[model samples]
Target: MNSKYQDFVPLKAIPFVEFLINEHNFTLKIVHQRETKHGDFRSLPNGKFQITVNNNLNKHQFLLTLIHEIAHHVTHQKFGKAKPHGKEWKTVFQHLMLPFLNPEMYPMEILPYLANYLKNPKASTDSDVKLSLALKGNIAAAGKNFIFAIPQGSLFIFKDIIYQRGAKRRTRYECLNLANKKAYLFHQNVEVASYQREYS
Candidate 1:
Protein backbone atom coordinates (compact mmCIF):
# COMPACT_ATOMS: atom_id res chain seq x y z
CA MET A 1 0.00 0.00 0.00
CA ASN A 2 1.21 3.49 -0.78
CA SER A 3 1.92 5.62 2.29
CA LYS A 4 -0.09 8.41 0.77
CA TYR A 5 -3.19 6.21 0.87
CA GLN A 6 -2.88 4.79 4.36
CA ASP A 7 -6.43 5.72 5.30
CA PHE A 8 -8.15 3.62 2.67
CA VAL A 9 -9.56 0.41 4.12
CA PRO A 10 -7.61 -2.64 2.98
CA LEU A 11 -10.81 -4.58 2.37
CA LYS A 12 -11.81 -2.04 -0.24
CA ALA A 13 -8.42 -1.86 -1.92
CA ILE A 14 -7.54 -5.53 -2.15
CA PRO A 15 -10.83 -6.69 -3.63
CA PHE A 16 -10.79 -4.01 -6.29
CA VAL A 17 -7.29 -4.96 -7.39
CA GLU A 18 -8.26 -8.59 -7.41
CA PHE A 19 -11.28 -7.70 -9.52
CA LEU A 20 -8.99 -6.08 -12.11
CA ILE A 21 -6.51 -8.93 -12.15
CA ASN A 22 -9.12 -11.64 -12.25
CA GLU A 23 -11.69 -10.03 -14.53
CA HIS A 24 -9.65 -7.64 -16.67
CA ASN A 25 -6.17 -9.23 -16.56
CA PHE A 26 -4.32 -6.15 -15.38
CA THR A 27 -1.12 -5.84 -13.37
CA LEU A 28 -1.06 -2.96 -10.87
CA LYS A 29 2.14 -1.13 -10.06
CA ILE A 30 2.74 1.37 -7.28
CA VAL A 31 5.62 3.68 -7.94
CA HIS A 32 7.29 6.58 -6.14
CA GLN A 33 8.16 9.66 -8.13
CA ARG A 34 7.93 13.43 -8.17
CA GLU A 35 4.44 14.66 -8.92
CA THR A 36 4.01 14.93 -12.64
CA LYS A 37 1.75 17.64 -14.00
CA HIS A 38 -0.81 14.97 -15.02
CA GLY A 39 -3.01 12.12 -13.87
CA ASP A 40 -2.30 9.44 -11.27
CA PHE A 41 -3.05 6.30 -13.27
CA ARG A 42 -1.33 5.10 -16.44
CA SER A 43 -1.38 1.86 -18.43
CA LEU A 44 1.62 0.45 -20.24
CA PRO A 45 1.48 -1.59 -23.42
CA ASN A 46 2.10 -4.87 -21.61
CA GLY A 47 -1.15 -4.75 -19.63
CA LYS A 48 0.61 -3.18 -16.67
CA PHE A 49 -0.89 -0.15 -14.95
CA GLN A 50 0.46 2.44 -12.52
CA ILE A 51 -1.68 4.13 -9.88
CA THR A 52 -0.25 7.13 -8.08
CA VAL A 53 -2.09 8.85 -5.26
CA ASN A 54 -0.16 11.92 -4.34
CA ASN A 55 0.62 12.43 -0.68
CA ASN A 56 -1.40 15.60 -0.71
CA LEU A 57 -4.60 14.22 -2.16
CA ASN A 58 -7.52 13.65 0.23
CA LYS A 59 -8.93 10.21 0.84
CA HIS A 60 -12.04 10.58 -1.34
CA GLN A 61 -10.21 12.09 -4.31
CA PHE A 62 -7.49 9.47 -4.08
CA LEU A 63 -9.99 6.67 -4.11
CA LEU A 64 -11.83 8.26 -7.00
CA THR A 65 -8.60 8.62 -8.92
CA LEU A 66 -7.62 5.07 -8.17
CA ILE A 67 -10.94 3.80 -9.51
CA HIS A 68 -10.61 6.10 -12.50
CA GLU A 69 -7.24 4.57 -13.34
CA ILE A 70 -8.59 1.09 -12.89
CA ALA A 71 -11.33 2.05 -15.27
CA HIS A 72 -8.69 2.93 -17.84
CA HIS A 73 -7.20 -0.51 -17.42
CA VAL A 74 -10.61 -2.07 -17.95
CA THR A 75 -11.26 0.03 -21.05
CA HIS A 76 -7.92 -0.92 -22.57
CA GLN A 77 -8.66 -4.57 -22.10
CA LYS A 78 -12.22 -4.30 -23.38
CA PHE A 79 -11.76 -2.04 -26.42
CA GLY A 80 -8.03 -2.34 -27.12
CA LYS A 81 -7.85 1.43 -26.75
CA ALA A 82 -9.94 4.35 -25.56
CA LYS A 83 -10.53 7.87 -26.71
CA PRO A 84 -10.09 10.47 -23.96
CA HIS A 85 -13.33 10.51 -21.95
CA GLY A 86 -15.10 8.60 -24.72
CA LYS A 87 -18.04 6.26 -24.28
CA GLU A 88 -16.05 3.17 -23.35
CA TRP A 89 -13.91 4.89 -20.76
CA LYS A 90 -16.84 6.77 -19.29
CA THR A 91 -18.82 3.58 -18.93
CA VAL A 92 -16.03 1.77 -17.14
CA PHE A 93 -15.14 4.76 -15.03
CA GLN A 94 -18.71 5.13 -13.85
CA HIS A 95 -18.95 1.43 -13.12
CA LEU A 96 -15.96 1.64 -10.81
CA MET A 97 -16.89 5.03 -9.43
CA LEU A 98 -20.30 4.22 -7.96
CA PRO A 99 -19.13 1.47 -5.64
CA PHE A 100 -17.09 3.82 -3.46
CA LEU A 101 -18.82 7.13 -3.90
CA ASN A 102 -20.67 8.77 -1.00
CA PRO A 103 -22.20 12.12 -0.19
CA GLU A 104 -18.77 13.64 0.23
CA MET A 105 -17.41 12.25 -3.01
CA TYR A 106 -20.55 13.18 -4.92
CA PRO A 107 -22.25 16.19 -3.46
CA MET A 108 -25.30 17.90 -4.89
CA GLU A 109 -23.22 21.02 -5.57
CA ILE A 110 -21.14 19.03 -8.05
CA LEU A 111 -23.88 16.85 -9.52
CA PRO A 112 -24.71 18.89 -12.59
CA TYR A 113 -21.13 19.10 -13.75
CA LEU A 114 -20.47 15.46 -13.06
CA ALA A 115 -23.74 14.42 -14.67
CA ASN A 116 -23.02 16.31 -17.85
CA TYR A 117 -19.54 14.85 -18.12
CA LEU A 118 -20.73 11.37 -17.21
CA LYS A 119 -23.41 11.48 -19.91
CA ASN A 120 -25.82 8.98 -18.35
CA PRO A 121 -23.83 7.85 -15.36
CA LYS A 122 -26.81 6.07 -13.83
CA ALA A 123 -26.97 2.87 -15.90
CA SER A 124 -30.12 0.79 -16.18
CA THR A 125 -29.06 -1.08 -13.05
CA ASP A 126 -28.56 1.99 -10.92
CA SER A 127 -31.83 3.90 -10.68
CA ASP A 128 -35.54 3.16 -10.28
CA VAL A 129 -36.68 6.49 -11.71
CA LYS A 130 -37.11 6.35 -15.45
CA LEU A 131 -37.32 9.34 -17.75
CA SER A 132 -40.49 9.56 -19.78
CA LEU A 133 -40.91 9.59 -23.56
CA ALA A 134 -42.35 13.08 -23.72
CA LEU A 135 -39.37 14.53 -21.82
CA LYS A 136 -37.10 13.63 -24.69
CA GLY A 137 -39.31 15.63 -26.99
CA ASN A 138 -39.04 18.68 -24.71
CA ILE A 139 -42.44 17.93 -23.17
CA ALA A 140 -43.08 16.61 -19.67
CA ALA A 141 -45.00 13.81 -17.98
CA ALA A 142 -47.83 14.56 -15.56
CA GLY A 143 -49.20 12.04 -13.07
CA LYS A 144 -49.62 9.05 -15.40
CA ASN A 145 -51.12 11.26 -18.04
CA PHE A 146 -47.97 11.80 -20.10
CA ILE A 147 -48.09 12.37 -23.86
CA PHE A 148 -45.66 10.99 -26.40
CA ALA A 149 -44.77 12.71 -29.65
CA ILE A 150 -41.44 11.00 -30.21
CA PRO A 151 -40.78 9.80 -33.74
CA GLN A 152 -39.18 6.56 -34.80
CA GLY A 153 -35.46 5.95 -34.32
CA SER A 154 -35.47 7.33 -30.77
CA LEU A 155 -32.99 6.06 -28.19
CA PHE A 156 -33.85 5.62 -24.53
CA ILE A 157 -32.28 4.69 -21.28
CA PHE A 158 -34.58 2.74 -19.00
CA LYS A 159 -33.81 3.11 -15.33
CA ASP A 160 -33.53 0.22 -12.94
CA ILE A 161 -36.93 -0.81 -11.52
CA ILE A 162 -37.88 -3.11 -8.72
CA TYR A 163 -40.43 -5.80 -9.43
CA GLN A 164 -42.09 -8.06 -6.87
CA ARG A 165 -42.36 -11.64 -7.95
CA GLY A 166 -45.88 -12.93 -8.85
CA ALA A 167 -47.32 -9.44 -8.81
CA LYS A 168 -50.09 -9.30 -11.40
CA ARG A 169 -50.45 -5.53 -11.60
CA ARG A 170 -46.99 -4.83 -12.97
CA THR A 171 -45.66 -1.51 -14.14
CA ARG A 172 -45.30 -1.45 -17.88
CA TYR A 173 -43.42 0.89 -20.20
CA GLU A 174 -43.48 1.15 -23.98
CA CYS A 175 -41.70 3.40 -26.39
CA LEU A 176 -40.13 3.46 -29.81
CA ASN A 177 -36.50 3.42 -30.81
CA LEU A 178 -36.54 6.34 -33.17
CA ALA A 179 -33.20 5.52 -34.73
CA ASN A 180 -34.10 1.89 -35.42
CA LYS A 181 -37.81 2.57 -35.76
CA LYS A 182 -38.46 -0.37 -33.44
CA ALA A 183 -40.87 -0.58 -30.53
CA TYR A 184 -39.42 -1.26 -27.09
CA LEU A 185 -41.44 -2.31 -24.09
CA PHE A 186 -40.34 -3.21 -20.60
CA HIS A 187 -42.10 -4.27 -17.44
CA GLN A 188 -40.70 -2.44 -14.45
CA ASN A 189 -42.28 -4.90 -12.06
CA VAL A 190 -40.42 -7.85 -13.53
CA GLU A 191 -37.05 -9.46 -13.26
CA VAL A 192 -34.24 -7.39 -14.64
CA ALA A 193 -33.44 -8.57 -18.12
CA SER A 194 -30.25 -10.43 -18.69
CA TYR A 195 -27.42 -8.65 -20.42
CA GLN A 196 -28.41 -8.68 -24.05
CA ARG A 197 -26.72 -7.21 -27.09
CA GLU A 198 -29.74 -4.94 -27.52
CA TYR A 199 -28.57 -2.50 -24.84
CA SER A 200 -25.05 -2.38 -26.17
Candidate 2:
Protein backbone atom coordinates (compact mmCIF):
# COMPACT_ATOMS: atom_id res chain seq x y z
CA MET A 1 0.00 0.00 0.00
CA ASN A 2 1.25 3.48 -0.75
CA SER A 3 2.01 5.25 2.53
CA LYS A 4 0.58 8.47 1.15
CA TYR A 5 -2.88 7.00 0.50
CA GLN A 6 -2.89 4.53 3.38
CA ASP A 7 -4.74 6.97 5.60
CA PHE A 8 -7.26 8.07 2.95
CA VAL A 9 -8.45 4.76 1.48
CA PRO A 10 -9.78 1.79 3.43
CA LEU A 11 -8.03 -1.59 3.49
CA LYS A 12 -10.46 -3.12 0.96
CA ALA A 13 -9.86 -0.24 -1.46
CA ILE A 14 -6.07 -0.27 -1.27
CA PRO A 15 -5.62 -2.30 -4.44
CA PHE A 16 -7.73 0.09 -6.51
CA VAL A 17 -5.99 3.07 -4.94
CA GLU A 18 -2.60 1.57 -5.76
CA PHE A 19 -3.72 0.88 -9.31
CA LEU A 20 -4.61 4.55 -9.82
CA ILE A 21 -1.43 5.83 -8.26
CA ASN A 22 0.95 3.39 -9.96
CA GLU A 23 -0.79 3.26 -13.30
CA HIS A 24 -1.64 6.93 -13.66
CA ASN A 25 1.01 8.53 -11.46
CA PHE A 26 -1.59 10.70 -9.72
CA THR A 27 -1.15 12.22 -6.30
CA LEU A 28 -4.33 11.46 -4.33
CA LYS A 29 -5.76 13.40 -1.42
CA ILE A 30 -8.94 12.81 0.60
CA VAL A 31 -10.21 16.06 1.93
CA HIS A 32 -13.16 17.25 4.01
CA GLN A 33 -16.65 17.37 2.55
CA ARG A 34 -17.04 19.34 -0.68
CA GLU A 35 -20.68 20.43 -1.10
CA THR A 36 -20.83 20.50 -4.88
CA LYS A 37 -18.68 17.51 -5.80
CA HIS A 38 -17.66 14.11 -4.55
CA GLY A 39 -14.24 14.19 -6.21
CA ASP A 40 -12.20 16.08 -8.76
CA PHE A 41 -8.89 15.95 -10.70
CA ARG A 42 -6.60 18.68 -11.94
CA SER A 43 -3.17 19.20 -13.41
CA LEU A 44 -1.18 21.70 -11.40
CA PRO A 45 0.48 24.62 -13.15
CA ASN A 46 3.76 23.04 -12.05
CA GLY A 47 2.76 19.92 -14.07
CA LYS A 48 1.90 17.68 -11.14
CA PHE A 49 -1.37 15.73 -11.42
CA GLN A 50 -3.63 15.42 -8.37
CA ILE A 51 -7.04 13.97 -7.45
CA THR A 52 -9.10 14.81 -4.41
CA VAL A 53 -12.07 12.87 -3.01
CA ASN A 54 -14.39 13.79 -0.17
CA ASN A 55 -13.43 11.94 3.03
CA ASN A 56 -17.01 11.47 4.23
CA LEU A 57 -18.01 8.90 1.64
CA ASN A 58 -18.40 5.25 2.60
CA LYS A 59 -15.92 2.68 1.30
CA HIS A 60 -17.95 1.83 -1.81
CA GLN A 61 -18.70 5.47 -2.60
CA PHE A 62 -15.07 6.37 -1.92
CA LEU A 63 -13.82 3.80 -4.40
CA LEU A 64 -16.33 4.86 -7.04
CA THR A 65 -15.52 8.55 -6.57
CA LEU A 66 -11.78 7.86 -6.68
CA ILE A 67 -12.11 5.88 -9.90
CA HIS A 68 -14.33 8.60 -11.38
CA GLU A 69 -11.72 11.25 -10.69
CA ILE A 70 -8.97 8.97 -11.97
CA ALA A 71 -10.92 8.59 -15.19
CA HIS A 72 -10.90 12.38 -15.51
CA HIS A 73 -7.13 12.40 -15.06
CA VAL A 74 -6.75 9.70 -17.67
CA THR A 75 -9.03 11.53 -20.09
CA HIS A 76 -7.13 14.77 -19.61
CA GLN A 77 -3.84 13.03 -20.34
CA LYS A 78 -5.14 11.44 -23.50
CA PHE A 79 -7.37 14.22 -24.88
CA GLY A 80 -5.93 17.36 -23.28
CA LYS A 81 -8.83 19.34 -21.73
CA ALA A 82 -11.76 18.04 -23.73
CA LYS A 83 -15.27 18.22 -22.27
CA PRO A 84 -15.18 17.24 -18.60
CA HIS A 85 -17.73 14.47 -18.98
CA GLY A 86 -17.50 13.99 -22.69
CA LYS A 87 -17.45 10.76 -24.67
CA GLU A 88 -13.76 10.18 -24.00
CA TRP A 89 -14.20 10.57 -20.28
CA LYS A 90 -17.28 8.34 -20.22
CA THR A 91 -15.48 5.65 -22.17
CA VAL A 92 -12.51 5.72 -19.81
CA PHE A 93 -14.78 5.85 -16.75
CA GLN A 94 -16.66 2.76 -17.84
CA HIS A 95 -13.44 0.99 -18.69
CA LEU A 96 -11.93 1.70 -15.29
CA MET A 97 -15.13 0.63 -13.54
CA LEU A 98 -15.42 -2.66 -15.44
CA PRO A 99 -13.04 -4.63 -13.25
CA PHE A 100 -14.78 -3.68 -10.03
CA LEU A 101 -18.32 -4.37 -11.17
CA ASN A 102 -18.93 -7.39 -9.00
CA PRO A 103 -20.18 -8.58 -5.63
CA GLU A 104 -16.70 -8.45 -4.17
CA MET A 105 -16.19 -4.77 -4.85
CA TYR A 106 -19.80 -3.59 -4.47
CA PRO A 107 -22.93 -4.89 -2.78
CA MET A 108 -25.09 -7.15 -4.93
CA GLU A 109 -27.95 -4.69 -4.75
CA ILE A 110 -25.84 -1.87 -6.11
CA LEU A 111 -23.80 -3.92 -8.62
CA PRO A 112 -26.58 -4.35 -11.13
CA TYR A 113 -27.65 -0.72 -11.04
CA LEU A 114 -24.03 0.36 -11.25
CA ALA A 115 -23.47 -1.83 -14.26
CA ASN A 116 -26.47 -0.30 -15.98
CA TYR A 117 -25.31 3.16 -15.00
CA LEU A 118 -21.93 2.60 -16.66
CA LYS A 119 -23.60 1.82 -19.97
CA ASN A 120 -24.46 5.52 -20.23
CA PRO A 121 -22.60 7.21 -17.45
CA LYS A 122 -23.86 10.46 -15.98
CA ALA A 123 -22.09 13.46 -14.46
CA SER A 124 -22.48 12.15 -10.92
CA THR A 125 -23.75 9.11 -9.05
CA ASP A 126 -26.36 11.24 -7.34
CA SER A 127 -27.93 11.73 -10.75
CA ASP A 128 -28.76 8.00 -10.85
CA VAL A 129 -31.33 7.36 -8.16
CA LYS A 130 -31.42 3.60 -8.35
CA LEU A 131 -27.66 3.27 -8.10
CA SER A 132 -27.38 6.03 -5.54
CA LEU A 133 -30.09 4.52 -3.35
CA ALA A 134 -28.49 1.11 -3.52
CA LEU A 135 -25.12 2.56 -2.55
CA LYS A 136 -26.72 4.48 0.31
CA GLY A 137 -28.23 1.25 1.62
CA ASN A 138 -24.74 -0.07 2.31
CA ILE A 139 -24.05 2.66 4.82
CA ALA A 140 -25.77 3.23 8.14
CA ALA A 141 -29.01 5.13 7.71
CA ALA A 142 -28.60 8.87 8.35
CA GLY A 143 -32.04 9.02 10.08
CA LYS A 144 -33.09 11.79 7.71
CA ASN A 145 -36.03 11.15 5.44
CA PHE A 146 -35.29 10.76 1.73
CA ILE A 147 -37.02 12.87 -0.88
CA PHE A 148 -38.49 9.74 -2.44
CA ALA A 149 -40.14 8.83 0.83
CA ILE A 150 -42.44 11.82 0.62
CA PRO A 151 -45.69 11.42 -1.27
CA GLN A 152 -46.23 13.47 -4.38
CA GLY A 153 -47.82 16.85 -3.58
CA SER A 154 -46.57 16.60 0.01
CA LEU A 155 -44.65 19.56 1.35
CA PHE A 156 -41.13 19.09 2.65
CA ILE A 157 -38.25 21.18 3.85
CA PHE A 158 -34.91 21.01 2.02
CA LYS A 159 -31.99 23.26 2.77
CA ASP A 160 -34.35 25.33 4.93
CA ILE A 161 -36.83 26.02 2.12
CA ILE A 162 -40.31 24.56 1.85
CA TYR A 163 -41.27 22.74 -1.31
CA GLN A 164 -44.03 20.48 -2.62
CA ARG A 165 -42.90 17.25 -4.23
CA GLY A 166 -44.15 16.84 -7.76
CA ALA A 167 -44.05 14.10 -10.35
CA LYS A 168 -40.86 12.13 -10.91
CA ARG A 169 -38.89 13.11 -13.95
CA ARG A 170 -36.61 10.12 -14.42
CA THR A 171 -34.16 10.05 -11.50
CA ARG A 172 -35.10 13.39 -10.02
CA TYR A 173 -38.27 14.75 -8.47
CA GLU A 174 -39.72 18.02 -9.66
CA CYS A 175 -40.53 20.33 -6.77
CA LEU A 176 -42.10 23.75 -6.36
CA ASN A 177 -40.61 25.98 -3.71
CA LEU A 178 -43.32 27.74 -1.69
CA ALA A 179 -41.27 30.84 -1.07
CA ASN A 180 -40.37 31.62 -4.63
CA LYS A 181 -43.12 29.59 -6.36
CA LYS A 182 -40.42 28.35 -8.70
CA ALA A 183 -39.90 24.78 -9.86
CA TYR A 184 -36.68 22.95 -9.03
CA LEU A 185 -35.27 19.53 -9.69
CA PHE A 186 -33.99 17.52 -6.77
CA HIS A 187 -32.19 14.23 -6.61
CA GLN A 188 -34.44 11.33 -5.65
CA ASN A 189 -32.20 10.29 -2.81
CA VAL A 190 -31.70 13.72 -1.30
CA GLU A 191 -32.20 13.72 2.48
CA VAL A 192 -34.93 16.08 3.60
CA ALA A 193 -37.06 16.65 6.63
CA SER A 194 -40.82 16.40 6.30
CA TYR A 195 -42.96 19.35 7.30
CA GLN A 196 -46.10 18.81 9.38
CA ARG A 197 -49.30 20.17 7.94
CA GLU A 198 -51.22 22.70 10.01
CA TYR A 199 -55.01 22.66 10.09
CA SER A 200 -56.79 26.00 10.15
Candidate 3:
Protein backbone atom coordinates (compact mmCIF):
# COMPACT_ATOMS: atom_id res chain seq x y z
CA MET A 1 0.00 0.00 0.00
CA ASN A 2 1.29 3.46 -0.90
CA SER A 3 1.64 5.97 1.93
CA LYS A 4 0.47 8.85 -0.26
CA TYR A 5 -3.05 7.43 -0.76
CA GLN A 6 -3.49 6.56 2.91
CA ASP A 7 -5.76 9.52 3.50
CA PHE A 8 -7.65 9.09 0.23
CA VAL A 9 -8.82 5.47 0.46
CA PRO A 10 -9.98 3.61 3.54
CA LEU A 11 -7.65 1.10 5.20
CA LYS A 12 -9.80 -1.89 4.20
CA ALA A 13 -9.63 -0.84 0.56
CA ILE A 14 -5.81 -0.71 0.59
CA PRO A 15 -5.46 -4.38 -0.32
CA PHE A 16 -7.53 -3.96 -3.49
CA VAL A 17 -5.51 -0.86 -4.39
CA GLU A 18 -2.31 -2.80 -3.87
CA PHE A 19 -3.64 -5.62 -6.01
CA LEU A 20 -4.32 -3.24 -8.90
CA ILE A 21 -0.94 -1.55 -8.60
CA ASN A 22 1.00 -4.79 -8.37
CA GLU A 23 -0.89 -6.84 -10.94
CA HIS A 24 -1.52 -4.13 -13.54
CA ASN A 25 1.33 -1.70 -12.80
CA PHE A 26 -1.15 1.11 -12.56
CA THR A 27 -0.26 4.53 -11.15
CA LEU A 28 -2.95 5.93 -8.85
CA LYS A 29 -3.82 9.57 -8.58
CA ILE A 30 -6.42 11.24 -6.31
CA VAL A 31 -7.65 14.30 -8.13
CA HIS A 32 -9.88 17.17 -7.07
CA GLN A 33 -13.65 16.79 -7.18
CA ARG A 34 -15.07 16.76 -10.68
CA GLU A 35 -18.74 17.57 -11.10
CA THR A 36 -19.17 15.52 -14.27
CA LYS A 37 -17.26 12.32 -13.58
CA HIS A 38 -16.07 10.29 -10.61
CA GLY A 39 -12.92 8.72 -12.03
CA ASP A 40 -10.92 8.13 -15.20
CA PHE A 41 -8.25 5.81 -16.61
CA ARG A 42 -5.62 6.68 -19.18
CA SER A 43 -3.05 4.48 -20.88
CA LEU A 44 -0.06 6.62 -21.70
CA PRO A 45 1.97 6.24 -24.91
CA ASN A 46 4.94 4.94 -22.94
CA GLY A 47 2.97 1.89 -21.78
CA LYS A 48 2.29 3.45 -18.40
CA PHE A 49 -1.29 3.27 -17.16
CA GLN A 50 -2.85 5.76 -14.73
CA ILE A 51 -6.10 5.90 -12.76
CA THR A 52 -7.52 9.04 -11.19
CA VAL A 53 -10.39 9.14 -8.70
CA ASN A 54 -12.20 12.05 -7.14
CA ASN A 55 -10.92 13.10 -3.71
CA ASN A 56 -14.38 14.03 -2.43
CA LEU A 57 -15.80 10.51 -2.58
CA ASN A 58 -16.57 8.65 0.63
CA LYS A 59 -14.95 5.32 1.50
CA HIS A 60 -17.38 3.09 -0.38
CA GLN A 61 -17.74 5.38 -3.40
CA PHE A 62 -13.98 5.89 -3.61
CA LEU A 63 -13.34 2.17 -3.65
CA LEU A 64 -16.11 1.59 -6.18
CA THR A 65 -14.83 4.30 -8.50
CA LEU A 66 -11.27 2.97 -8.20
CA ILE A 67 -12.40 -0.50 -9.19
CA HIS A 68 -14.50 0.96 -12.01
CA GLU A 69 -11.48 2.72 -13.49
CA ILE A 70 -9.29 -0.32 -12.98
CA ALA A 71 -11.85 -2.38 -14.85
CA HIS A 72 -11.43 0.06 -17.70
CA HIS A 73 -7.67 -0.36 -17.54
CA VAL A 74 -7.96 -4.15 -17.57
CA THR A 75 -10.51 -4.08 -20.38
CA HIS A 76 -8.34 -1.83 -22.48
CA GLN A 77 -5.43 -4.16 -21.98
CA LYS A 78 -7.45 -7.23 -22.98
CA PHE A 79 -9.23 -5.64 -25.96
CA GLY A 80 -7.87 -2.37 -27.19
CA LYS A 81 -10.42 0.29 -28.25
CA ALA A 82 -13.34 -1.82 -27.09
CA LYS A 83 -16.65 -0.32 -26.02
CA PRO A 84 -16.12 1.57 -22.76
CA HIS A 85 -18.78 -0.26 -20.77
CA GLY A 86 -19.13 -3.28 -22.98
CA LYS A 87 -19.45 -6.90 -21.88
CA GLU A 88 -15.72 -7.25 -21.28
CA TRP A 89 -15.62 -4.29 -18.89
CA LYS A 90 -18.73 -5.50 -17.08
CA THR A 91 -17.18 -8.91 -16.54
CA VAL A 92 -14.00 -7.38 -15.15
CA PHE A 93 -15.88 -4.94 -12.98
CA GLN A 94 -18.11 -7.68 -11.51
CA HIS A 95 -15.14 -9.93 -10.85
CA LEU A 96 -13.21 -7.18 -9.14
CA MET A 97 -16.22 -6.05 -7.11
CA LEU A 98 -17.21 -9.52 -5.89
CA PRO A 99 -14.91 -9.56 -2.89
CA PHE A 100 -16.17 -6.22 -1.62
CA LEU A 101 -19.85 -7.09 -1.62
CA ASN A 102 -19.96 -8.31 1.96
CA PRO A 103 -21.03 -6.38 5.03
CA GLU A 104 -17.41 -6.27 6.19
CA MET A 105 -16.47 -4.16 3.20
CA TYR A 106 -19.70 -2.16 2.91
CA PRO A 107 -22.36 -1.03 5.34
CA MET A 108 -25.24 -3.45 5.82
CA GLU A 109 -27.72 -0.86 4.64
CA ILE A 110 -25.93 -0.43 1.34
CA LEU A 111 -24.64 -3.98 0.80
CA PRO A 112 -27.93 -5.37 -0.52
CA TYR A 113 -28.37 -2.61 -3.08
CA LEU A 114 -24.76 -2.93 -4.19
CA ALA A 115 -25.04 -6.67 -4.54
CA ASN A 116 -28.10 -6.36 -6.76
CA TYR A 117 -26.38 -3.65 -8.79
CA LEU A 118 -23.42 -5.89 -9.59
CA LYS A 119 -25.75 -8.30 -11.38
CA ASN A 120 -26.04 -5.80 -14.24
CA PRO A 121 -23.88 -2.79 -13.63
CA LYS A 122 -24.49 0.46 -15.46
CA ALA A 123 -22.05 2.93 -17.03
CA SER A 124 -22.08 4.95 -13.81
CA THR A 125 -23.28 4.32 -10.27
CA ASP A 126 -25.38 7.44 -10.60
CA SER A 127 -27.41 5.64 -13.21
CA ASP A 128 -28.61 3.21 -10.52
CA VAL A 129 -30.78 5.40 -8.36
CA LYS A 130 -31.21 2.90 -5.55
CA LEU A 131 -27.53 2.11 -5.24
CA SER A 132 -26.47 5.69 -5.70
CA LEU A 133 -28.92 6.90 -3.04
CA ALA A 134 -27.81 4.17 -0.68
CA LEU A 135 -24.20 5.17 -1.07
CA LYS A 136 -25.02 8.84 -0.53
CA GLY A 137 -27.03 7.97 2.58
CA ASN A 138 -23.89 6.61 4.21
CA ILE A 139 -22.14 9.95 3.93
CA ALA A 140 -22.87 12.84 6.25
CA ALA A 141 -25.52 15.15 4.85
CA ALA A 142 -24.28 18.49 3.56
CA GLY A 143 -25.54 21.78 5.00
CA LYS A 144 -27.40 22.42 1.78
CA ASN A 145 -30.83 20.91 1.16
CA PHE A 146 -31.43 18.05 -1.23
CA ILE A 147 -33.05 18.97 -4.54
CA PHE A 148 -35.79 16.39 -4.25
CA ALA A 149 -36.77 17.75 -0.84
CA ILE A 150 -37.64 21.14 -2.27
CA PRO A 151 -40.97 22.08 -3.77
CA GLN A 152 -41.57 22.49 -7.47
CA GLY A 153 -40.91 26.02 -8.78
CA SER A 154 -38.57 26.65 -5.84
CA LEU A 155 -35.41 28.65 -6.48
CA PHE A 156 -32.04 27.30 -5.44
CA ILE A 157 -28.33 27.81 -5.95
CA PHE A 158 -26.39 24.97 -7.54
CA LYS A 159 -22.72 25.23 -8.42
CA ASP A 160 -23.01 29.01 -8.06
CA ILE A 161 -25.83 29.17 -10.57
CA ILE A 162 -29.44 30.00 -9.81
CA TYR A 163 -32.16 27.72 -11.06
CA GLN A 164 -35.87 27.18 -10.56
CA ARG A 165 -37.10 23.64 -10.24
CA GLY A 166 -39.66 22.89 -12.91
CA ALA A 167 -41.22 19.42 -13.26
CA LYS A 168 -40.13 15.92 -12.57
CA ARG A 169 -38.96 13.96 -15.58
CA ARG A 170 -38.62 10.40 -14.41
CA THR A 171 -35.42 10.27 -12.32
CA ARG A 172 -34.40 13.88 -12.89
CA TYR A 173 -35.94 17.32 -12.53
CA GLU A 174 -36.21 19.89 -15.26
CA CYS A 175 -34.58 23.10 -14.08
CA LEU A 176 -34.36 26.42 -15.87
CA ASN A 177 -31.06 28.21 -15.28
CA LEU A 178 -31.81 31.79 -14.37
CA ALA A 179 -28.68 33.28 -15.87
CA ASN A 180 -29.37 32.33 -19.47
CA LYS A 181 -32.89 30.88 -19.02
CA LYS A 182 -31.64 27.65 -20.54
CA ALA A 183 -33.29 24.51 -19.26
CA TYR A 184 -31.17 21.64 -17.97
CA LEU A 185 -31.80 18.33 -16.32
CA PHE A 186 -30.48 17.62 -12.82
CA HIS A 187 -30.52 14.48 -10.79
CA GLN A 188 -33.39 14.44 -8.33
CA ASN A 189 -31.09 13.89 -5.39
CA VAL A 190 -28.63 16.70 -6.10
CA GLU A 191 -27.87 18.94 -3.10
CA VAL A 192 -28.30 22.67 -3.34
CA ALA A 193 -28.60 25.63 -1.00
CA SER A 194 -32.00 27.24 -1.19
CA TYR A 195 -32.10 30.93 -2.16
CA GLN A 196 -34.74 32.78 -0.20
CA ARG A 197 -36.71 35.17 -2.32
CA GLU A 198 -37.13 38.69 -0.97
CA TYR A 199 -40.66 40.14 -0.69
CA SER A 200 -40.87 43.68 -1.97
- CA error at residue 174 for candidate 1, angstroms: 51
Tens-digit lDDT track for model 3 on 10-62?
Answer: 67667867777789988988889998899999988998999999989888889
130 in model 2: Cα distance from truth in Å?
Answer: 0.7
The lDDT of model 2 is 0.83
Clash pairs (backbone) in predicted model 2: none
Tens digits of per-residue lDDT for model 2, 100-137: 88777787878889899999999999888788888878
Please state the error at residue 190 of candidate 3 in Å: 1.7
By lDDT, highest first, what's the ranking? 3, 2, 1
Worst 10 residues of 1 by lDDT: 126-135
The best candidate in terms of TM-score? 3
Q: What is the lDDT of residue 135 in candidate 2?
A: 81
Which is better, 1 or 2, measured by lDDT? 2
- For candidate 1, lDDT tens digit of each residue in 1-200? 45323564233454554555467555444444333311355676875666554443333334445566667667777897677457897888877766544444454444344445345543221122232121122223221212122222333333332211221234544544444556555444212321122355
Relative to the true structure, candidate 2 reaches a TM of 0.85
